[model samples]
Target: MEQPVHHFSELFEQLGLASDAEAIEAFIQRHAPLPESVALHEASFWSPSQAELLRNALEDDADWAEVVDHLDASLRKP
Candidate 1:
């Protein structure tokens, strides 16, 4: 079975970011579309811990993997 869809709030919380609506909107406006050349883990916007979380999620294909992958694709330019 497919996993339930994960919300951006969950992602923000996992990254230790503010998950309030205002914060989420501001974060999206500021960083939603990261450059094509910038890997998710390399984005300066993330804290070191957040970056490490992303890296580990991607590498390990853990429960967070699907959301992390969605984030990776969403952030990058097509």
Candidate 2:
């Protein structure tokens, strides 16, 4: 079975996403595995507001820079 995701918000926080619409969406898309289209049909089943926020992030480039910086730091771990 797929690993249990206790809370979707955890996904955002783990990715260091800002609590903005675009960032949430990007987080979802980035983490969601292939063959699963990132759509509210699946996402909406959870929380509409959160899902919408994620969708908006997917559409906008709002949090790209910060996320990248965070990623660079994470990658340097020994």
Candidate 3:
């Protein structure tokens, strides 16, 4: 079985964000509970490049998609 190469820290790095565990957790906490009406890529907090990366990852189902989905879930209401 193949292990996924993408992870939350790496995703943050790709987004040009702080990639440490504490930073990631804080970021998630800060922006969490995102409304069901919003798509992850459409979130206003991201920069243009970050949004584009997220959009492409999901739209193309790129290698980053799995972790991207994880992040999206983390930010939204359970």
Candidate 2 is scored at a TM of: 0.31
Clashing residue pairs found in predicted model 1:
none
lDDT per model vs. reference: 0.82, 0.44, 0.92
Instruction: Please tell me which predicted candidate would have the highest lDDT against the true structure.
Output: 3
TM-score of each: 0.77, 0.31, 0.91
- Model 2, 1-78: lDDT tens digits are 543423434445644446466775664455443233434323433466545554554457334434433432332333
For model 3, how does the per-residue alpha-carbon lDDT over 1-78 read when each residue is reduced to its tens digit?
764688789999999999999999899999998999999998999999999999999999788999999999999954
lDDT of 1 by residue, 1-78 (tens): 776677767988999889888887677677878887788999998889999999998898777888888777767633
TM-score of 3: 0.91
Best by TM-score: 3
Q: Could you tell me which 10 consecutive residues in candidate 3 have the lowest summed lDDT?
A: 1-10
Ranking by TM-score: 3, 1, 2
Worst 10 residues of 1 by lDDT: 69-78
Cα error, residue 43 of model 3, in Å, equals: 0.7
- Candidate 3 contains a number of clashing pairs equal to 0
